[model samples]
Every structure is written in structure tokens, then in C-alpha cells.
Target: MTSLTLAGIRKRFGKVDVIRGVDLRVADGEFVVFVGPSGCGKSTLLRMIAGLEDISEGELRIGDRIVNEVQPAKRGVAMVFQSYALYPHLTVRDNMGFGLKVRGVPPHERRQRVEAAAATLKLDALLQRFPRELSGGQRQRVAIGRAIVGEPDVFLFDEPLSNLDAELRVHMRSEIASLHKRLGNTMIYVTHDQIEAMTLADKIVVLRDGQVEQVGTPRQLYERPGNLFVAQFIGSPKMNILPIEAVAGKLPGQPKTASLVGVRPEDLELTEPGSGFVDARILISEYTGASSLLHVQLPSGQVFLVAHDGEAPPADTSVGLAVEPGRLHFFADSGRRAD
Candidate 1:
């Protein structure tokens, strides 16, 4: 296993800067995920780490070596792309062993490595099958097995589960997590899916518009986001952003500089009308089996979501909502989180 370090990393295309001054480190055997929305440079940064893109200005070190000028193959890293990228005519065994074969590894060693990887990925039975004969999940496993056979120092994944169906994505997420535990290689994954980041990563690097937003563990980012962008971007149903005036009277001793307040959907609880922090009328209630999502419109005309377990209040019914003072996240006009 190897650690990775990026110092003042930057990427530019012509005059446009796509990745701006990123510095991060991955510990040995750490699972680090790069997560953000589209056009946010997450993939660009990953490509740079893989030596697939030129780093305009920065230092990239894998293990003890500076590899900014190293070729992709010599960098000792393997990449699993969103697409399986398997050869149609090649069986799983050949596809997984292809890299080793090209490097002139002995036939016996290649077979042993391929079989070991196949067993690890639970693809032993499917090794003789071609890509067209495999299920989506099986094909994805083959792709990962190919990377494993290379015995790379670092494993890079670029949204590898995006092509699978919803159920398969979930299954593959577990599979990948298990693989990480078993191999214990330093892995870097890029995905727009925050759920995947939360579940799979030992550390998450959140990016937005070519810059780093925040870096933390899943719990840290969710519980104490660094800024408004991260607070809103990292949560499901997104945190509700409301003008400070809406809750100024309800929250005493709040910072005077706070211009916006954020409350997560799960943090908002329905209360008796006129008794809670804010009053809103229910606009719609979406029943999602385990819980109901209430879309409530505040007096300020902003709508926020409340997660409720009991039956939801009917539309047009006025209800009061409250969140613990400690749970409320305050932000200034500049979108920075206020202490």
C-alpha cells in the first residue's frame, strides 16, 4: 500500500482554470472519495492523479516518488472508469490478465494472479464467460478484477457504479467496500453521488466549481459543515435555507452577522400551531413508505422540507415547526458558516 499527496495542484485548459490550487493527502490504505456536482472538477482532479491529465502547476507524490512526469503505466495506479470498458470477445480471465500479459509477465504467474483476483471478487465461476454473457454487476466486477490483477499501489475509481441499475449500484457499493477492506490499498474514487461518498469513504473531499469546498469524514461533514455550499450540497433533501429574519425571534443569542439559517429536513419537527419557532402551511406531503416528506411554505414564501413519521398534515393546514438551537446552522451573506 502507498499514500498519496497533492501539493498546490492546479489544472488549466487553455485560459480557463478547471482545478484551482488543491492540496490533499491520502494515507496508506485510506479510502478517499472526491464528491461534487457536474462541472465541478472532481473528475479532472482524479484524472490528474491518475496521470491521465497534465497538472498545470503542483506536486503529486505517490509513496516516496514525485510522479508528475511519470507515465500512467509506470505510476503504479489502476483506474476503473464509469464504463466497464471490457473487450467483447475476451473472456473475463483474459481481460483481467491482459495488462500483465502485455507487460510480459510469465503465463503461470498471470494465471495465478487472475484466479486469485477472480476468487476475491467472487467471479471465479464467470472467468470463462465473455462480457456479453455477464450481467451488469458481473461486468463491473470484472472491470475491478482487472485493476486488482495489476497489483497497483493506488486504485482509482471514476464513478464505476453509475452504469448499474439502482439495486445493482447498492450491491456493488457493498462489494467495493468489502474489496477495500480485503485489499487495503489506497483508493481514490470520484462520484457525484453523496450517498456513495458517505458510505464508502474514510475521507471525503467536497469540491465545487474547480475548488475544494471541504474535506472531512462523513460524520464531520454532515454534522458540522464548513460552509453553506457544503451544508446544502452534502445532505439529502438538501438542508433548508431560510432568511435569518424568519427565525430571528425564535433563536436568541444568535450571531448578529448570520444572514441565513439552515435546518436539515430530519431536524425539523412539527409542533402545535403558533407554539414553535416558525409557522408554515403544508404545501404537499409525499408519502415515502417509511416516512413522509412534508413541503411546507413559511410566511417568508420559502419552502422547506420536514421529515415526518406519522401521517402528514393536510395541505393548506398551518403548522409550527421547531429545530434545536444547536442543530441550526448559521451562514453569513457571503455563504460562509458563522460560528
Candidate 2:
């Protein structure tokens, strides 16, 4: 295993700069993920690390060696792409051994390595199957196995589970998490899916337009987001934001005139008709399997969401809502959290 570091990494195409001055340190054997919207320069950063794209300006180090100009193969990094990239004509065994073969490893050693990886990935039963004969999940396992056989110091996954169905995606996610735990190699995953990042990453690096937005653990980002963008982006069903005047008179302690206040759906509770801050007319009630989401319209003509019990009040019913003081997040005029 090895640690990877990027200092002032930048990339540009003519006049448009895609990645601007990013500095990150990935500790040895840590599972880190990069997450952002499309065209946010995440893939570009990954490519730069893989040596597939040249660094416009910066330094990259792997295991104490400055590898800015080193070739991709000598960097001891293996990348698993979104498409699986398995050879159509090659069987699983052959595909796993292909890299070693090209590198001129002895035949007996290549066979041993492939067999070991196949056993680890549970692909031993499908060794003779070609790509066309395998399911999507199986094909992805093969791709991972190919990288495993290389015994790379760092493993890079570029949205490797994006091609699978929902059920298979969940299954592959568990498999990948297990693989990381078992191998304990340095892993860097890039994905736009927030759930994947939350579940897989020991640390998440959130990026936007080539800039680092925030870097934190899943709980930290979910509970104490630094800005409006991160607060809205990191949670499921999103946090409900309302103008400060809507609840300004209801909350305890002076709020120093914040521009906006964020309340998560789970943070608001449904109470008796005369109980708390405001009376809301239920605009809509959606019943998910485990919880019912209530869309409540406040007196100021603003709508907010609240999560209620699975068996919640009917639509158009009048309800009272109360929020815990500690649960409210305050943002200033600049959209950053007020310290």
C-alpha cells in the first residue's frame, strides 16, 4: 500500500481551466472518494493521477517518490473504468492474466496469480466464460479481478458500479467495500452518486467546478455542512430551507439576522394543533415504505417538508410544526454557515 499526494494540481485546455490548484493528501490504505456533479473536473483529476492526462502545473507523489513525469505503468496504480472494458473474445482467466502476459511474466506465475484473484472475487466458477456470457455484476467483478491480479499499490474506481441495475448496484457496492476491507490498499473512487460516496468513503472530497467545496466524513458533512451547497447536496430528500422571518419570532435566542435557516425534514416534528411555531396546511402527503413525507404550507406562503410516521395525517389537514433549536442550521448572506 502507498500514500498519494497532490500539491497545487492544475489542468487547463487553452483558455478554459478545468482543474485549478488542488492540494490533497490521501493517507496510505485509506478509502477516499471524490464526488461532484458532471463536468466538475472529477474525472479529469482522476485521469491526471493515472497519468492518462498530463498535469498542467503541480506535483504528484506516490510512496515518497515524485511521480509527476513517471509513466502510468510504473506508478503501480490500476484503474477500473465504468464500462468494465473487458475483452469480448477473452475468457475470464485470460482477461485477468492479460496484463501480466503483456508484461512478460512467466506462464506458471501468471496462472497462479489469476487463480488466486479469481478465488478471492468468487469468479472461480466462471473462469471459462467470456464477457458476453457474464452478467453485468459478474463482468464488473472480472474487471476488479483484473486489477487485483496486478497487485497494485493504489486502486482507482471510476464509477465502476454505474452500469448495473439497482439491486446489482447495491450488491456490487457491498462487494467493493468488502474488497477494500480485505485488501486494505489505498483506494480512490470518483462518483457523482452521493449514496455511494457516503457508504464507501472514509473521507469524502466534495468538488464543484474544479474547486474543493468541502472534505469531511459522511456524518460530518450530513450533520454540519459548511455551506448552503453542501447542506443541500449531501442529504437525502434535502434539507428544508426557509427565510429567517418565517421562524424568527418563534426560535429562542437572537439569531444575529441570518439570511436563511435550514431545517431537515427529519428535524421537524408534527404536533397538536396549537403546539409549536406555526400552523401549516398539509399540501401533500407521500407515503414511502417506512415513512410518510408531509409537504406543509406555512402562513408566509412557503412550503416545507416534514417526515412523519408511516401512518400520517390525511392531506389538507391542519397541523402544527416545531423544530429543535439545535437542529436548525443558519446561513449568512454569502450562503456560508454562520460560525
Best lDDT among the predictions, by candidate number: 1
The digit string of per-residue lDDT tens for model 1 on 12-77 reads 999999999998999999999999999999999999989999999999999999999999999999
In model 1, the runs with Cα more than 4 Å from the true position are none
How well does each candidate superpose onto the true structure, as a TM-score?
0.99, 0.97
Look at candidate 1 and tell me the lDDT of residue 310: 84
Alpha carbon lDDT of residue 299, candidate 1? 88
Alpha carbon deviation, residue 144, candidate 2 (Å): 0.5
Query: Candidate 1 at 52: error in angstroms?
Result: 0.8
Candidate 1: residue 106 Cα off by (Å): 0.3
Alpha carbon lDDT of each predicted model: 0.94, 0.91
lDDT of 2 at 224: 92
Model 2 whole-model lDDT (C-alpha atoms)? 0.91
Clashing residue pairs in candidate 1 are: none
